[model samples]
Target: MKVKMILPALTEAISPHWRPIKYSLFPPLGLATIAAFFQLDDEIVIQDEHIEAIDLEDEPDLVVIQVYITSAYRAYELADYYRQRGIYVALGGLHVTALPEEASLHADTIFIGPGEDTWPQFLKHWQVGKPEKVYVSRERSLIDLPKIRRDLIKRHLYLVPNSIVVSRGCPHHCDFCYKESFFKGGKSFYTETVDRALEEIAELPGRHLFFLDDHLFGDTRFASGLFDGMKGMGRVWQAAGTVHAVLQPNLLEKAVESGLRSLFIGFETLNSTNLRQQHKYHNLNRDYTEAIRRLHDLGVMINGSFVFGMDEDDETVFDRTVEWAINNGIETATFHILTPYPGTDLYQRMATENRLTSDNWDLYDTRHVVFQPNKMTAEVLEAGYLCAYRDFYRWNAIFQSVSTKNTWEQKLRHLIYAGAWKKFEFLWDLIIRAEQVNKVLPMLESVLDGFGKKSAIAIIA
Candidate 1:
């Protein structure tokens, strides 16, 4: 069967007048992983709309669309478009998993939960013209899964094209986390074999890899075995994990020795009350300074993530968090306004209180504030989010954070990273201006055309 797989982009990301220059920051691993399950006879075409245009003119037997909450509307549009042309459409991902019925209205078949088990079954039935309306997977075993078909991807498009997923789901089910809904029962699972992971890494072209796992150290036993297997591989990687995992007995040392260069930790809030409210109590037990010091001592850079607008937070949260991060020599910090995504506990509570401002999925991005805060206004939350970013990326903060680096190269790299964050803010402003121009361009063009026609008439006269 001829199949076309799509990784839909948010409308704002693909606007003619306002597209981001750095659209292909990451390849669509989800689509590629799904593509890996297809038979050799299946002629497949993959399109990542964020990096390139979708060829709507292509005629395929089936269309597979990956859905994210921010791209839900666009995914629905693409599904409807392909379906109108008599193509079978399959929709799956976090968004569809959350609202399968709503997605079913647009696609021929919708998948709930992970596609590892359901996808192959659907494909088998599809070939015989007996595809089901919904396919659901209840498997928790993360063994014997096929390696992602990186050959299907245009690797040159992504900044870091070489990546792998060693684990799935996260144990810490924070109130605002979408993982709680995506993973059935919010259970974290690890790959049964480290040999398969090592084989995948060996096949890849690059020495540096990025593990797209929700949390690499969520399961210490699996992590320890994986790290021990990776020790002699001579490959460096970065992944996300909790502070508790880093401080685990003997695991952190083994992980670093195995080439874990950096980690992204969710130090969500500085306040203990906020941590409890978010159900991120694990973060409260460890001193933030001690965690940062230990990670830095292991020659690993820290990418600390923080969120504003928790019930126990006030405007002071931003400055305090930024200052703490800078003081502790954090390599980088990502700030977010508290966002209540669909299918999250926070969203349910906000809906019950009638505090949700809108169901606009586009605005659900972490940068936007969609719900009322308990202690401060939404405006204040938004402002604080911006302030946190600006302060963290400021020159003084960057210098302070890099001062502890042992080598000049490390210091220089951190400085460059800080500058990149600053430039990102500029790029954001440029997009907004481009959007404004997009809104008025048609009218401007019409006026110019009228003026040219009148000028031609005068010349004829």
Candidate 2:
């Protein structure tokens, strides 16, 4: 038997704001993970469209295509092609789970939730016969799962080939969070046993490991045990977590001692009212500035994420958000236009109010305006988003942000890391298109390396 697992290029890839370096940073760990279910004797192929063009000319017994909201159309096109040629096609991922009715139209078998449990079921059915048209996930089991088939990954193609996901979903469901709709049935948040997670870490070959978990600190016991085990691992890592997790006593310390170099925090909106509007209770009343100070004090670089075009946002929101980020000396920032992805409370609310301007999936990339704004027009929102990114990454802005660092090493790291992040896009495009992303890993690691013994004893203040 021959199997082909593909991760189609997501909507962001084709967007005007798309950058090759961003997508080239992580390979499709999801596809490689599910490849674990394939029989050893079966020939397997894994492809990430972000890294390379997919070969639609191939014939395989089973074709598995991971579907994301932006990549839904491309996935459907590929699935239709394979199905027309009498090959079996399976569709699954965040988008498929939320919009199964639409996805079912394109797939011979459509998995309606996380595939950790459903993929094996599909394999069983495929061994004897065709899989059912739909399989909804009713379980959240991450314990002792077969190690992800990392061997199937072309690690050299990705800047962070060591990216991993030890947990699933998040504990707090903001109104706009996709996890709320993705895991509608069973346990929404779960993690692997501490021992198992440590084992995966131990097996990963590198000095840098990125925990791709939505919230690595979701379970205190699991997180502590995992971090304790990693004390001497000599690894520098990164992950995303809520402000609530960062403010938790002792948890942030444990993570730092385990070599957590940078963290992504969703400081979505500054206004507390918008927090209530979006049901982001975790961030409500949390001291955003104090959180930044704590992470800086612990030598953890910050990648603050902000969402714009909320109900309370006005034209000044863009410059205000960017200014706040720079004032706090955030090492990096990600700005979004408050994309209300389908199957979220945000989407339902907008649809109910008849504010959705477009149902075109392509325009839902967050870089585009898909819904009407309250305090400002859609054009104002879109223009503001672009201005935010432009203002934040300017040469002057990088210098301003870097100047806030305490030590020269910290300043240099921020300057190099943040500067190269956006300013060197042309070079990154060249390197990525030429399939030489591996060549740039050492440079990234060097910046991470600067977060060394010095950071442990120093505080920016």
Q: How close is candidate 2 to the true structure, as a TM-score?
A: 0.96
lDDT of 1 by residue, 82-189 (tens): 899899899999999888888899999999988888888997897788999998878666688777888898776565577688777877778989878887643446
lDDT tens digits, residue span 1-461, model 2: 99999999987785354356888888788888898878889899999988888998898998999998889999999999999999989899998988989998988889887888988888888778766889988978987578789999999999999999988888888998877899889889998888888888999987898889998888988899999999999888999888889999999999999998889999999999999999999898899999999998888889999999899999999998999999899989999998889999999999999999998897888899999999999999999999999999998998999999898888888887898888888888778768889877755766776734545224221
The regions of model 1 sitting more than 4 angstroms off are 11-23, 185-188, 406-409, 424-461
Error of 2 at 319 (Å): 1.2
Residue 49 miss distance in model 2 (angstroms): 0.5
Residue pairs that clash (backbone atoms under 3 angstroms), model 1: none
Candidate 2 wrongly placed segments (more than 4 Å) = 15-19, 451-461
TM-score of each: 0.88, 0.96
Q: After superposition on all CA atoms, how large is the RMSD of candidate 1?
A: 11.8
